[model samples]
Target chain A: MLLLQCPWCGDRSEEEFACGGEGDIVRPLVPEELDDRAWGDYVFMRRNEKGIHFERWRHAHGCGRWFNVARSTVTHEILASYQVGDDRPELPE
Target chain B: MSRARHEPLAHLALAAAGETTGPDAGVTLQAAPYQPAVILRGESGNAAFLEAFRAGMGFDLPLAANHVNSHAGATALWLGPSEWLVQSTTGQAEHGRLAAALTGHRHAIIDHGDGQQIIRVSGPRARDVLSKLCPLDLEGPDLAPGRCARSILARCSILLHPLPGGGYHIHVGRSFADYVWRLLADAGLEFGVAIGGAG
Candidate 1:
C-alpha cells in the first residue's frame, strides 16, 4: 500500500482511495458553445503520459474529496499529491 | 430535538459475543459506555452552519483543520469530509456540554458513544498488516504521528491516524466494527499479539 498524502487529510492509505484519470483537463463552461468534435475530445481525450503524469483522485473510502496527483507513469511512484487548485506537479529534475 | 432513547447496539453486542479473548471467551469488548461523541450529520452547503457550530464549541474542530487535540489520556482525531472523532479520558464531562452547546445549530447530533470501537495496532509489523488492507503507503517519515486520512479498510471505509506511540487508530463504521476487529485479530495472531482494551 502506498502512503498518499491528501492535501486536506494528510497521508492516508491506498485502500481508501479511487484513482481518477489524468487531471488539468478544463471542460467548456457551456456544452452548447463547443462543437460536437470539441465536446467529444474534451470528454474522452487524455494524454495518458508514460513519464510524468497529472491525474485526479478521490479519497473514496476516506474523506470522499477529489484531489490531483502527480507521479511517474512508468514506475507508478507518486511525485506529489496536492489540492486541485494547488500547483501542478512538474517533471522531476 | 430531544435526545433519542439510549438503545444498546444489538449488532455490536452480537459481535462481541463471538469474542474469545475476554475473561470467559476468546474476545474482549472494552465498552466505551459514555455517550462521548455527539455527532452532527447534515446535508451539503452548510458551511455557514458548520462554522457556527465550530464557533459554538469554543474551540475549532474543523474537519480539515489538521489540528490535533491532545487531552489527558485521550486523543481527538479529525476524519474526512465533515467529521471529527473525540476520544475522551476516563471522566471527561465535556461531551455532554459540547453536545448541549451544539444543539439547534442547524445540524442533527447523534450519540455515537456506542457506535464505534477504537482499534489500535502497534509494533514493527503493524504497518505490514495495514499495507495489505489500506491503499496508502506507511513507511519512513510518511506515516508519522499527527497524520491522518480517510480510506477503505478491509472493504469498509474508515479513518486511519498514525498515533504518537507509533500505532494506528482505525475509526470504522459501527456496522463494520466486528468485521474489522476480526480481520485485525486474525492478522495480528501471526505476530504473537493479543487484542484487548486500550491503555
Candidate 2:
C-alpha cells in the first residue's frame, strides 16, 4: 500500500486516488479536424521514456483535484509532483 | 448523515462519536469545534436541492463534491448511496438555511456541524503519517486535493480532504478526536511540525 501525498489534502492512502497515467498528454482539439494518421499519432504515440516520466493523477476521494507527477517508470519512484497550472512543469531527467 | 459504504470505518467512527451504533444505524454525527457542518441526505433528484441549498445559503465558496466531483473550494462528500455531506467552513446558520431549503425532498438532513474536528498535516513527511494507519496506495499524483477519500487512522475512520497547499484537511469522529490528535502529534515528531486546531 503506497501512501500518496495529496499536496492539498496533506497525505492519504493510495486507495483514495485514481492513477491517470503518463501526464502531459493532450488529446487532439478536434477529432474530425485531424486525419486518421494524425489522430492515431496523438492517441497511440508516446515517448515511452524509461527513467523519469510525467504522469497525470486525480484525487478521486479527497478534494477532487487533478495534478501531475514526475516519477520513474522503472521503479515507480516519484521524483517530484506539481499541479497542472504550476509554471508548466518540465519532464524530469 | 446516511451511511456510505466507500469508507465504512469513517461512518463507524462517527457512530462511536455520536454514540449511535448497531447494524441498523443510518445517519451518524461528528462534531467540528467552532465550525458546524450540515449532513444532508438527498432523495432522487436531490441534486437540484443541493444546488438550491447552496444558493439559499448564499454559498459563494465554489463547492466541489469530493467522492462525487473533484474541483476545489467547497465540495460534497458521498456519505451513502443517497446521502452526502456538504462540507463548507462558511457558517452553520447559513447551512441551516440550506438544510431547511431541502426539507421535503425525501432527504434526511442532520446538522453534523459540531460532531467532528478538523486538523491539518503537511510538509514532506505528511504521507508517512497516514501510512501508519491506512491501507491504500498514495503515490504519484493520485492523492492530491480536490481529491477526498475515507480511511481509518488510529483505528478510527476519517474523511481526508486534500488541500492545495501541500497539506491535508482531516475530519475524524469526535470520540476519537483526541486520540487522532495525539497520533498526529506523534507522527509529526521527525518533521518537528506543529499541530494546531482549525477555526
Candidate 3:
C-alpha cells in the first residue's frame, strides 16, 4: 500500500487520499476569447507523462487539505510534496 | 419547549452486549456520547485570529500540525492550517464564548455538538487494537500524549487523540460511530473488550 504524506496530517495510507489528476492546470483568464480547440485542449488534454509528474492529491479521510505531489510514475517514488499555493518543485534531470 | 436528542451510540446496545470475556481482556471501551465538539476556522497567520482564540479558549491555538492544546475544561486539536476541533464538556457555553469572541473576524465557528461521537479506548493492549484498523504507526513518538492525528481507520475518517496514560480517544461522524465501535470490538476480541456506559 502506498503511504502518502499529507502536508497537514503527516504520512498516512494512500487509502485516505483522493488523486485529483494533473496539477498546475490553470483556468484561462478569458474563456470567451478561446477557440473550440483551445477549450478542448484545456478540458481534456493531459501530459500523462511516464517519468516524474506533478499531480494534485486531497487528504480526503484525514485533514482534508489539498497538496501537490511530484512523483515518478515509473517508480512511484514521491520526489516531493508541497502545499497547494507553492511553486512546483524543480524536476531532476 | 423541549426536544429529544439522541447520542450517536444510543443504538449500540452496549449494555446488553454483555461484558468483555477472555483471560487477557486488555482493552476497555466507553462512549463519550454528546461531548461538545466545535470546528473553528481562521487564518493561522492572522495575529488577531490567534489572539482572539487564545483570549476566548483560555489557551493558544496549536499552530504545529497534529498537536493538541489542553485546558481544564476543553482541548483543541489542530485539524489543518486554518481549522481546529475544540472539544469540551461544557458544549454550549464553549461554543457561545468562541462565537462571540470571533465576531467580525474572518472566522467560522461550527457547532458539531450532535454531529459526531467520541469513543475512548484504553488499556495495555489498546494500541494493539487500533493497529489492526489504522495504518499509522501507533508506537511512534510522534503520537505521544498531547498530540493528535487525522487518519483512516476501518475505512472511515477518524481523529485519533492519544491519551496520557495509554489508549486513544477517537472521533468520527455520528453516522459511523457504530461501525467504528464494532470494528474495534472485533479487533479486540482476542484480547477481550469491555463496553462501558457513556461518560
Candidate 4:
C-alpha cells in the first residue's frame, strides 16, 4: 500500500485518503461570460500526463483535510505534498 | 440538571460475562461510557479564538497536530487545523463549563451528546491487538501518551489515543461501537482477553 503523507496527520496508508482528480483547477472569474466551448473545456479538460502530475488528495480517514500532492504517475513516487491553500511548489522542468 | 443517559454499549451483556479481573488475562476491554464529548471548531491561528478556548477550558488548546492536552477532567484532541474533540470524564458539569466559556466567541461548539463511544483496551498485548487491524506503526514514538491519530481500524474510522500504560482508548462512531468491539475481541482471542462492565 502506498504511504501518503497527510499535511496534518503525518504519513498514513493510502486507504485513509481519497484522490481528487487534478490540482489547481481554478474556477473562471467570469463563468457567465465564457462561451459554451470554453466552459466545456474548463469543466472537462485535464492534463492526464504520464510523468509528473499535481493532484488533490483528501485525508478522508485521518484529519479530513484536503491537500495537494506532486507525484510521478509512472513511478508512483510522491515528489511533495502541501496544504491546499499554499502556493504550488516549483516543479522541475 | 439534565438526566444522566446511558451509552450505546450500556445494553451489551458481554461486559458482565468477560473475565476482567484476572491477572492471567493478556488484555482487558471496557467502555468509557457517557463521557461528555464536544466538537470545537475555530481558526487555531486566531488569537481571540485561542484566548477564548483557554479561558473556557482552563488549558491551552493543543496547536500541534495529532497532539492532545488535558486539564482537570477534560482532554482535547487535535482533530485538524481548526477542529478539536473535547471530552470530559468528570461529566456534564465540566462540559457545561466549557460550553459556557466559549459562548461569546466566534467559534462553533457542538455537543456530540454521546455520539461517539470509547473502548479502552489495555494489557501486555494491547499493542498487538491494534497492530492486527491498524496500518499505523504503533510501536513508534509518534503514538506515545498525549499523542493521538485518526486512522482506520477494521475498515472503521477511529481516533486512537495511546494511554500512558500499554493500552489505548479508541474512539469510534457510536453506531460502529459493537462492530469494533467484536473485531477487537476476535483479534484478541488468543491473548486471553477479558472485558469489563460497559460503563
The lDDT of each candidate is 0.64, 0.60, 0.86, 0.86
Best by DockQ: 4
TM-score of chain B of 3: 0.94
Q: Which residue pairs show collisions in model 3?
A: none
Model 3 C-alpha lDDT per residue in residues B29-136, reported as the tens digit of each score:
988857777899899999998998888778999999889997868889998888999888665447888888888789988988788888999978899999999988
Per-residue lDDT, model 1, residue B155, is: 87
DockQ of each: 0.46, 0.12, 0.80, 0.85
Tell me which of candidates 1 and 4 scores higher on TM-score: 4
Docking category of candidate 2 = incorrect
Docking class of 4: high
lDDT of 2 by residue, B29-68 (tens): 2223445466765543456765665565544222333343
User: Sorted by DockQ, highest first, which candidate order results?
Assistant: 4, 3, 1, 2
Estimate, for each residue in B47-165, the C-alpha lDDT of model 4 and write its tens digit.
88788778877899899999999998888999999999988867754656776777767788788747898999898988999999999899888899999999999799999999866
The pairs that clash in candidate 4 are: none
Model 1: share of real contacts kept:
0.83
lDDT of 3 at A53: 88
Question: What lDDT is reached at residue B72 by model 2?
Answer: 34
Candidate order (TM-score)? 3, 4, 1, 2
Off by over 4 Å in 2: A1-93, B1-33, B44-51, B54-75, B140-142, B197-199
